[model samples]
Target: MPSNIPFRPFHRPAPDISATRKPDGSLIVRSNIPLGNYEANIGAYWRAAADRFPDRAFLVKCSPDDTWPELSYRTASEQSDRISSYLLSRGYGPDKSIMILSSNSFAHATLMMGAVQVGIPVTQLSPSYSLVGNDFTKLKYAVELTEPGMIFAEDGNTYAAAFESLDLSDKDVVTISGKDHGGIRFDDLLGPVDSVSVEAAFSAVTGESLAKILFTSGSTGMPKAVPNTHEMLCAAQKTLEHVSESLDAVNDPTRVLDWLPWHHTYGGNVNFFGIARVCGTLFMDDGKPTPGLFGRTIENLKRISPSRFSTVPAAYSYLADQMEEDEELGHAFFKNVKICQYGGAALSQEMFERMQQLAIKYIGMRIPFGTGWGATETTGTGTAVHWDSEKVGLIGVPTPGITVKILPVGEKLEIRIKGPNVHAGYYKRPDLTAQYFDEEGYYCIGDAVKWVDPDYPEKGMIFDGRVAEDFKLANGTWVSTGSLRLSLIDALDPLARDVVIAGHDRDEVGILVLLTEAMQKKYADQPGALSADGRRIVAPALIEAVQEKISRYNQGNPSPSRRVGRALILAEPLSVDKNEITDKQYINQGAVLSNRADLVALLFADDGSGGVIKLNKNNAMKGDKDVRNEQADTA
Candidate 1:
C-alpha cells in the first residue's frame, strides 16, 4: 500500500536584521543601507580591494604543470585600469557594451573588470554555446541584445570565428587575448594609464546604471535580455554573504578551485563575485566539469585543496565514480572542502549518499552538501540551503532582504521572489519584463515548491517541480515531471545520467532513461544485455531491479502521479547538438519529447512484442559491431 504522505507547510519569522552565523561559521547580515546602485559596475569593489589588500593574492590561474599563476589585488586593479583606458580611448565606455567570449581565466576576469572600471557593461556569453555544430541561436540573441561596441575573444582563432560568424564588424574594436591572431594584441591594451582618471571614472558609476545584459537560454524563443546593475550584483553578493554568515564559515581565507563557465550566473555572479566579495583566492581551471575535461579538475584538485567546492550534479556523479575506484584521489579532492555546493539540477539520492560516504571516509567530517534555487535573472542564489544545517532538497530560507511568496496556481504554488538582487527588467524586452514580474513586483520563479513542515515556520521548504513542466494524464492525474525525474534519478543515481518522464495524457507515467557509459559497459556482456539504441533491450534481471527501485519510490509517495508505470532505456545520450539539453546539462523536457516523438509514439503503439518492442521501420538497428562503430564515431 502507498503511504499517505501528509502535506506540510513551512513558515519563517521575518528576517532578523542582526548578523547571523552560517552553518559553516561565517558572519552574514543584511546591510542597513541599500547597496548603492552602480549599474553592475564591479570596478569599485576592485578598487576597494586593491586599496585595502594591495598585496593579497586575488586571482590564480591553473596550468597543467600544477604551477598556479597568482595576481595581487593591486596589480590586477592596475592592469584592469589600463585595459579600461584602452577601451575608453577606443570609444567604448558607459552605455557602450563589450561582448566577452571566453572560458574562466584570469584574462576573462581582467577584461570583465576593465569594462566595469570604465563604466562599460561587459556581457559574457557561454563558450559552450559557441561550439562547432551546436546551436548558435543563443549567441546570436546575445549579440543582438548587447549590440556590442567591441568583441573580446580569449583566443584569436576560436572565439574570433564566433565573433565573425555573428557579423559584428560594425564594432570599432576587436581584441584578441594572445598574440599570433591577426587582430589587435592584448598587450597593446596594457599601456600606462592615469590611475586617478580610472578611479574617477569608477566613482562616476552608480549601482542603478546598467551593468550587464544577460541573455536567458531561449529554449522557447529568442533569449530574453535581462539587465543587471551594480546594485543587483551587490545585492546578490550580499545575499550569498548572508547565507554564508548564517552557516558561519565563509570568511576564512581559503582557496576556491572553480571550473564552471563564466557565462552562467552561478559562475559569473555567485562563484566568481561571491569569492571576490569574501576576499578569497580564486583559482580558474581551464577545463570544464564535463566528462571530457573533468580530468583537468581532478588534476587541479590534487594540487590545491579548495575549502569550498561548487559543481553541478553531473560532475558530482562523475566524481563519485572516480572516488569508488581511487580512495586516495577522493581524499585529496575533498581534503580541505568545508562546503560542497550543488545546483543547476536536482541531485539524486544515490549521488547524495555517495558524497556523504566519501566525505566520511576521506575528510573524517560530514562535510555538508548544499543545493539552491535561482536563475540568471535572480543574479545567482535567491534561496539556498545552509550546507552545515539542512536536509537534502530544502532550498532554505530566503536570503536577507529578499521576500518570497508562494502564489497559488491551481493545485500547486509558484515560487516568487522580490528583492534588490532581482533584475530591474529585461533589456528592450518590456513585454517579457511585464510578464515575468507580478503586480506586487515579485519575480515569478516558475518553480513549484512545498513546505515539508509548513506549521514549523522555521524549517524551510522543499522544491516540488517546475509548474510549467508538469502535465496531466487523461484521467486528470497531474504528473510533476521535475519531481518524477528527481525521484527516478535519486533511485538510480551514480548509474543514470538523466531520465525523461513521459505518459502525460496517458493512463500512467513512463520514462526514457540514459545510463552513464560506465554502467552501460558494466552490463554490456551480460546475458540478454542491451545494445545501444534509442530503444535498448535490457536483461530481464536488470529491468526487474529498476522496476523494484521505482516501486520502492512509489511506496513512499502520496499518489500514482509519483509512480512510473514503465520505462524505456535509451542506448544513446542526448547531445547538445540536438537541443535536448542545456549548457548546464539540464535535460530540456519539451525539446527531448519533441525530438523523441517517434520513440514516444512507439511506447504507446500497439505491437506484437509484449507492449515493449515495435518493428524498426527506419532500420535504426543493425548488430553490436555496427552499434559499437557508431558509438566510436560519437566519442
Candidate 2:
C-alpha cells in the first residue's frame, strides 16, 4: 500500500489553508491566496484569447456530412459577432432569453456565445428532457419557466413535436432547416449583422450580466431554473486557474474530447468555458457512457491524448473496465493524461483503486484523479481538489476567492459557500432565493462534509453526504445515505450499477440495488435468479453478495445508522425521464426514495413479499433467505 495514509504525494503543489472556529461553532477556511481579482467578464476574456491565439483550433468536430470542420478562435469570435448582429435585428435584446434545444455542436456553441455576448441569457435543455419522454412534461415546464423570447434547435424536425407542444405565438423559432413550425433559417438570422448595433450591445455586457440559466435535475418537484451570471462563470474559472497552476485552461492550449452536455454547469461553465477561455481545442464527442455508445467514447480517447478530461463516475467506471481489458487503449488513455477529474457523483473507492492500478501498469505512474463539490447554484466547481490525492471524494479546501464555512448540524458539519462564483438567485423566484442563503449570506447547498483529520485542516475534507439525502431511523439515528451508498457499491462491485438507501422513519437501513448488465451475462446458463425469458432478475448471487458485504461493513462500523438490515435487487433501472438520474449519472436521492415508497415498505415487510434478504442483528451471522423463500411457498 502507498505509505501516504490519507493522501498520496501531489504531482502539483496543493493549496494550504488554516481553519479557525467561530462563536457559532462553525469552521471558516480561506486560501492563502496572493492573486487579486480581475475584470470578471467572459466576453472580454474571449476577445483577448482570440487575439492571443487567433489561428488555434477552438472547436473540433469530425463531420460525416462534410470534410474536416474545425473552427478557429478568430473565426468563432467573428461568427459570434454575426450572431450578436442577428439577435439584434430581430428585436432580441439584453433582457430577452433565448433557449437552445439541442446537444453540444459547433452551431450550438457559436449561437450560445452570440447570445451571451450581447448580454442575453441562454438556456439549454437536456435533450432527454424533451426527446426521451413521451409526455415532454419537463420540457414544457422548463419552457414555461424560462418564458424565453426565442427557441433554437439545430434540426427543426427533431424538435417539431416540442414546438407544437409550446404555445409559440409570441416566441420565434431558430433552426437550420426552418421546419414548417413557422421560423426563419438560423443561417438567414446571421446575415443582418449591423456593426453599430452589435458593437453597442457588446459594449454593454458586464460582470453582473445574466449569462445562462440551467434547470436543476427535477428530483423533488418541478425543475427550478438556476440563473448563472457572468460573474459566477468567470469567478469559477478564475478560481480554477488560481488553485491549479498547471491547469491554465484560459491560457494553456490543451486538447479535450468531451460529451458532457453544455446545458449542465460542469460541461458548460467548466469544460465549455475552460476551452473557450484559454483558446484550447474541444472535440465534441457525440457518445454517451451507455453500453451502446461507450465504444465511441473509447474510439475518441484512442484518437486524442487529452491533457485533462472528466466525466461522471459511471463513465470512468466503464472506461476503467475497458482499459483493464484493452491494452492499446489503456496506454493511449494515460500516456498524456496529467489530470483525470470526476464529478456528478461520489466515485467509489473500488473505481479509484482500479484506475490507479491501470495507470501504474500502463504509464509506470498514477495520474492525479481530482473532483470538486458544488452545484448549479455555484456555477459548478466552488471547491475542487486541484492537487493529487491518494483517494477519491476529497472535495478539498475552498478555491481562491471562495470561502467554505462548515457549520455544525446535529452530528454532521453542513457545508456552505460565500463566493463570487455563487449564483445571484434562481430565475423568477425571489421567495425561494431568500430562503437559499443562510444568516451569513452563504448559499445553503444542502451538502455536508467531514474533516478527514481535524488536526490537519489542509489535508482537505471528504464529502460526508448530502444534508437533504440523510434520514432518521425509527429510533432516531441519522443515516448518512451518500457515504453508505458509496460503501455498498464498493463492497458489491460488478453487481450493483446504482443503489438507493431506504428505511427512513424505520427501524434500520435497507438497500435498493440496480444490477450490472455483466452479472446477467456471466450467470446466463446456470439456474440463476433471473425471471423467465430474462426480462426480470431476482439474482440470488447478488443478494448473497450484498448481504455478505453489508454484514462485513456493520462489523467494522458498528453503528445502527450504518448497519443495513435488508437489501433488494430492483429489476427496474433508474429513469432519466423521471429525473431519477441526471445526464451525468448522479442519482436524485429524494426522487428515488419518494418514487419507490412502496418498495421501501416492501423491504421491511414481515411477509417478505419484496424479495428482501433479512440479515441477523448480530454482525457475524450469515443472511437468511428462508424468510423470502418460505413466504413464496405459502403464497
Kindly list the per-residue Cα lDDT of model 2 for residues 280-372, writing each as its tens digit. Answer: 788888677765677777887887777777887777767877887899899888877777888887788888888878877887676778888
Count of steric clashes across candidates, in order: 31, 2
lDDT of each: 0.68, 0.77
Instruction: Give residue 502's error in model 2 in angstroms.
Output: 1.0
Q: In TM-score terms, which candidate is top?
A: 2
Candidate 1's residue-wise lDDT over 1-635, tens digit each?
11132111112223333334446432232323333333246555667667867888888888887477799988888888888888777777766888877677667788888887667888887676575554476677677767887766767666655655667457644455443334566677798896777767777877786777776766776667778788888778766665563332235575788876777787787877776666678888766656567878877887777877887778887777888898777878777676777887766766766777777677555666677788888898777665344357667656666667675686776778778889867888788888988877878869888765755534566788788889999899888776678778887665677788888798767788777656766655564465434246455445545555665655666366876655656755576666677677767888888889977875655442221322122312213243334344333
Stretches of model 2 off by over 4 angstroms after superposition: 3-11, 62-68, 132-135, 247-252, 520-528, 531-536, 618-635
